[model samples]
Target: MFTQDSKRALTAAALILATLTCGCAFESSPRGELGADQDLLKTCDPAAPPASFVQIDGTGSSNSDAIAAERMTAVEAIARRTAVCSGYLRVTVFSSSSAATAVLFDGALKMDGATENARLKRVPEAVSDVMNKVRSAYAPAVQALPQSGSDITAQLRLAAEWKQQLGGNYCLDLTVFSDGFQNIGVDLGARALSRQEAERLAEQPAVPKLAGASVVVAGLGRVAEGAPPSAVVEGLVSYYTKLCQRTEASSCTAVSDYATATR
Candidate 1:
């Protein structure tokens, strides 16, 4: 058996080969999957947080479902995207069925959070981890994405547009997942998705790029998908690294109607 050091060396060599050859051999996600294209993503300032209103309807449950089901939702799904120029982020949340989805109701972009500090408050470790990963993993890609470092300034224009809409101050609902118990003031209930739908959706086209940045599924809510939680989470992480344009402007709440899928 390979020692841990040897295994790590192999992994590093593989990462280098994959980067130079731009090969799909190292890791890849399916078509139509949630984060398949995230590798093409550019790094941004995590300290400032994402002002862009990018919504992440991950390959799993929606924020609305968590609150209505009184389920425990714990996830840190921050990502970096070229679309945002600066990194774009989306947080997954869970709460009692009676908890309000209103907190999740960010008008346009449909990417809202509970209270202003949700990202930093609930799971700061996960948040910090994702930001650092995005910065470290996507650094070369972000630098190489444009012809010159000066061109990066122009790219920021696109980022500015995305940010104007998603600036902080949105409310959100995070789900709980541990076996530990907690007291609730209100009684509530709801339903989760069938494994078939989740599985089928998993096969959908991923965003198209999964090798550029650090794609961590910090907090994944439990589901009937049935692979061990680690396997499922790892799979989702692979998937998240692949895709881009999670929800095009057409479905984007930011715009009134379809923007046409030119890509």
Candidate 2:
């Protein structure tokens, strides 16, 4: 019933409306609720992460053997040793239980401190399962994982970022598995944190590692020592890399004893 001109005008108006509606995501996505400021509208930023102490209730893993995760602690200890507050670094090896979804650090574990985050990606389970046998072993000191893929990554990646940013009061409970290490490696770390980044973190005028970091480390400690040859220790230390910085001295540890003896 409308004239041709009116019809065109209506179509144009509709198109403009659509554009405006989509504009919230103009920078990217208009998914999140409308906000007064751009920071509030950011959809990429991870949500608040939990930060409570978690102790691993690993079944088959023993405490004597020098696990690769133990050596990872030594790697992160560099900043602390140099009198820089790089926070606590916790690591767990899904070495055995390939499907084990161990607990990483949360924000609360940061214990009232400034935090930042960068989740590298593919940290095993999308949502860590607290109901696992391991968690059951370490009861009364834990928080269940969020019921979303993003929440899981955001929770952990932010914690890692929190470590990089604040230094003190930070923790990184990495569930480094054999296959999972294919992406991240010593080279990736070198690329991510060059000498410049190291100096920046080391030179920062702030707190020491432990004072602010009432950190708690957790893991299933499940790297099957079942000896066919290499599978057991491979969980703790991933030797799977193509263009990696290979060397016996590299902090990308293989086993605790070998690394210790070499050191």
Candidate 3:
């Protein structure tokens, strides 16, 4: 034990043993604290990310500076939320004809893999880019308001179709920014529609099947110029609720303000 060579040999052996032990521990305990931190770094659910669709009513009644401002705020919130989860976002403008409906922005919110702190730092910048694009696309899309009529039902159908086409185990979220005025086929503004009537209308074949989807009809009965009476607003809410239910959606929320419609 007193020999210098023996001491050095023992030191080397100990070092090798330590190295092997550490390697074995790392291989066997891949789910340890450090590994868990790496796992937690991924903020988005890779298997079932949310697929969000926003439909803006580009009709005469819904066009206003105030409404546009509110929409921008709502869209920013939505874009931030979606970006945080690395989900999908689609913005569309709907008017009289579904055929004439325009998709302003359709893309995914993507983030790079990094440490939690790094991810947090990068999130805002990523979200800002997305919101900028959304705003740019939305402005021109809604500038020319349609005067023919509002085809709200057709918008729902289009969303359903888009969801089907985007096949995945995605959580569907549909947000419609509208005044809840249906003038295409069924006139929701003629008179206050009864719940029974709404039920019947929802049951029609024209209604899209949106099973397992979450639906939010924001700014319901909130027109730019003339606000509908309370009774009419109530009727609009009932109609949308029944419509969503008839489509077999998991949840339905029809609110007067876009801010209140957030999940």
Candidate 4:
């Protein structure tokens, strides 16, 4: 038993402690991590020419035709038109089974240097070739989802590794084409993850951190042969948002309809 005044004081102290604890948690939370470092966002080169590194998920999908067409458009657009880079601009593609060599050059084919123009001219052609390679990486049939599912976490790790190699020397614009159904390589403690669980899991250390990058994720809602449930679509948007924030990407967006994604 306690006197009234003492009890009030104790309660107040407890409330203060709880408030402080909650604030600490939010400050350290994965969602807020990227915003914490305002400097990293500011450090990105505003003048840097846009560069695209596209990774196509080779996991089987039902609406692959739409996904492929939209994805190829983005690739061709980026390859054919990009600002001249005094330093080499890197354009590359990755699929579950294969990866294309980076087309590196200083400027576009229209640039004055013959060597630079020649290298730049090859990028679009190389991207076309890589698109074919990515198509082959997809499953042969809708029912033929691999025994192993899409390893999106692994792919994210790879992207982070690439960013590290790039070493903040240039701003990165990354694009990922996937159905947003991440499975197989993810560890959910031997069981499936509920939406809430999956979203929480994305904040954990298993996900890599990226800084000074902008990421766009396309082909989210559509699945192999049909569309995903609305709930799943919403969940993926949340999941990608959380994951991107953890990476410290300056921006992140998950678009279901690719036709309008660029807009």
- Highest TM-score: give the candidate number: 3
Off by over 4 Å in 1: 1-49, 52-217, 221-229, 244-263
Clashing pairs in 3: none
The digit string of per-residue lDDT tens for model 1 on 1-263 reads 87653453354333322321111222334542223333222122333323222222222222234322222111122121212123334322222221211122122221234643332232334344554543343223322222111111112122333344555632111111211111122111122324443334334532322122221122232332322344344433332222112412111111101111111
Ranking the candidates on lDDT from highest down gives 3, 4, 1, 2
TM-score of each: 0.22, 0.23, 0.77, 0.58
Summarize candidate 4's per-residue lDDT along 145-234 as a digit string, tens digits: 343456665666777776567553455566666776744444433344466876786776476766656676666655657555666677
Please count the clashing residue pairs in each candidate, in the order shown: 48, 14, 0, 4
**Tens-digit lDDT track for model 3 on 1-263?**
34653453344323221221101101112565334324433434566676878888888787888778777766765665566556788988888877867787788776666655555456678767876877787767776646788888888899899899888777677888889885477777877777777667656636888877777777778787877887777778888778777788877777665552111
The residue ranges of model 3 lying beyond 4 angstroms of the native Cα positions read: 1-46, 260-263
lDDT of 3: 0.68
Best by lDDT: 3
Candidate 2 segments whose C-alpha is farther than 4 A from its true place = 1-138, 141-160, 167-228, 231-250, 256-263
Each prediction's RMSD to truth: 18.9, 24.5, 18.9, 16.2
Model 3 RMSD, rounded to 1 decimal: 18.9
Rank list by TM-score: 3, 4, 2, 1
Q: In candidate 1, how many Å is residue 30 off?
A: 45
**Following a full C-alpha superposition, what root-mean-square deviation does model 4 have from the true structure?**
16.2
Preferred candidate (lDDT higher): 2 or 3? 3
Every candidate's lDDT: 0.26, 0.25, 0.68, 0.49
